[model samples]
Target: MRFTTQRKRFRDLSEQEIIALAISSEEDDAQIYRGYAESLRADYPASARIFDGMASEEDDHRARLIALHQQRFGSTIPLIRREHVAGYYTRRPVWLVENLGLDRIREEAEAMERDAERFYVAAAARTTDADTRRLLGDLAAAEAGHQESASDLANRHLDADTRSNEDATARRQFILTWVQPGLAGLMDGSVSTLAPIFATAFATQDTWTTFLVGVAASVGAGISMGFTEAASDDGELSGRGSPLKRGLASGIMTTVGGLGHALPYLITDFWTATILAFVIVFFELWAIAWIQNRYMETPFFRAAFQVVLGGALVLAAGILIGSG
Candidate 1:
């Protein structure tokens, strides 16, 4: 299927096909901008307004292009699109871009405009007719000026205070959706599993057995934490964000935290592996402390003291139990 479904080269397209491609590209761009507008409307109304303006601009472009097509060719334009042409510029799926940060979305928009400008320039160069070439050149200029238009729109819509508030909201959403749950999961995995893993290690003095226990504890804790986080909050009332995203963050981080020290047990030398594991535990505690300080806004020294003390106590308890 892949080999059979060959894409047409942009250079080989007729003027009508190029126009059709432009129409579809403009349509697609308009839809993407609308999707962005809708996505940000709830949180960043100012940014949403900017996207709305851009979408309207795209619609205008599409309408003008369609009028030109009707005047030159016919009422029935070909259904050619970006995907139909090989080496044509492509837009990312709106859903993928929408899920990113607000600034990232803006950057993507800029990139889209640049891609359009470049396409139009090349199309104008390849055109034989004076009118078609002039039209393509004009479109290219319009696309080039879009960044300035967007800036003007931002200036009118997104004032300094409003922009700051929206940015803050975005950051808070990120913290809630990712950092908070992930931190909790990491701390739980790194600290809670410590006693069991260390106890097993010291008790058995078997590297393979310790590795097995560590892996089991890490995986089990990751699963439990993931499910619990997802089930606990639907994100509608709490404003935490999508439960699936939070669950994934929590799950992945939890496993990583437990596996940090667990992996050292693969070394054949018992003392060497144990020493490395001890070192890894030290680093894990510090990392948890750092994350708390960075995202949760906890005082660094206090977070370090608490995490290290709690971990040390659990580790001591495990060692004492194993020795007895």
Candidate 2:
């Protein structure tokens, strides 16, 4: 409640404060675009150049806004920011934007311009003064033009071949950083846990004991896989991206894979629990095969055959040992 009262309402802000807010917002946006450019510079140089041009355009807008502020209210502009104004659009921090993939960054930039245009249109509507209304209207027009400018810049920098190559690189990076590690973790968790879980189930025929084992195994495997993935490579040399993200993808998927079958064991009836577990195992193996075929480019039939065969052998071994 205290924090809510601290923000100045948009209607309450004077013309000078609005202009000052615009200037600060432009400055912030330029810095964000520059950060995106810098982050993408190494891998996506063409995209980086597009962000550089956008930042330059933002600088021009800032200069124009500052000039207007000086003409109207002397040199000392107020330190008003978007945060100070209620109902103002907020930008994501540079660090957060920097972590996004190339395609996501592009989408974010487009959304930023769209948000700015909408804000200006709303501001123009609220102001009674002709001069302030005209300024807001012009700013809206400028923001609307930014979309065209971005397209022109992209056309100049990113030709068909260049765009295709960059897209391919992005896809490869995604597979390496997320899909590969996650798939491996899923496979490990699903296949490796199968033996112990089934063996314990058949050996004990106790639903509570089986469920406990499954939960313990799933959690332990998840933790171990997470640590292993994080410690395996720094991603600097391999270009696999952040180890933390990779580790999270691996760990969460691993836990999920183990949990898929384990959940069936929660059923009280022994035969019913065992039957559901078997059904879940079948689906899990098929899902893994589908993922391999879809992302890893493995042939569908071949992947299915391999996964199903391996899983069947494991199942048979566990059942036999437990029945003995």
Candidate 3:
């Protein structure tokens, strides 16, 4: 996916073409670093400063590479880049990378340095010309130096306390944006649909009919829950993060929770499907308990007791009602 084309091999490039490619690569890297800086500027200012420093360093590298190109081959640089070179590493779009997390962005920055260094080393090996080989070796050294510089840059911008706080804040944001909403959705879907689903199952004694009812219950509940969560808070005041993200987490998990038991009813045999559905319901209740224990930090046994007892009561009620 990273390779757009394999038209030009590394060994095939002339010294002038290689210089042009290096210059363009530096320019693109600088632009990407700047994009990262802009992306993290608001929430994580310290991290943004680190990226800003990196961007500035990349600009300096580009300028140096351009000067070298001018001195060696007289200014009219060729339009060569990573995409033109076979086996050259390319950068992921900044917008996409930034969406991963704070830690991931930092890792990506480090990876960029390593990728550049490796490319330069590989280019050096491919070139027969002494000057070009040496030039590439120097470029490789410069990229390796960037790793040290990045450490110094981070030290200047991010103190231990600040880094710890930023990481904690990011974790909290993740929990608020995804885990909490998803847990709530899973709980609602698994517990709320039990009565109607089981009652219909017992009453009809028809696997196909039961499956239909279960699907309707699950999907309807999922949609209602998703919209309710999204509309409940805009995340402006609550600090829960994006409405869209929370809605997606809630909606997807809600559907999954209900479908766990519902899917078992697809079997043609009535008793077989019903037995499987019951087994699935047992696991769903336990899973809800586990999630509560894990993320919500509820006592495991207490959560299990509450979930299992409530589910059992509901199931019993459904069976009694169906029998009558």
- Which candidate has the highest TM-score of all? 2
lDDT tens readout by residue for model 1, 112-195: 998889988998898788967887898899898776788889999988899899989999999999999999999989998888
Candidate 2 local lDDT, residue 276: 88
Q: Give the whole-model CA lDDT for all candidates, comma-separated.
A: 0.90, 0.90, 0.87
lDDT of 2 by residue, 2-29 (tens): 6456789988888888889889999998
Model 3 Cα lDDT, one tens digit per residue, 179-269: 9999888888888778877888889888788888889988998898889889999999898988988998898888888888788888988
Model 2 spans > 4 angstroms off = 1-4
RMSD of each: 1.8, 1.3, 2.9
Q: What's the lDDT of the predicted structure labeled candidate 3?
A: 0.87
TM-score of 3: 0.90
| Worst lDDT 10-window in candidate 2 | 1-10
Off by over 4 Å in 1: 1-5, 122-135
Query: For model 2, what is the error of residue 213's alpha carbon versus the real structure, in angstroms, after optimal superposition?
Result: 0.2
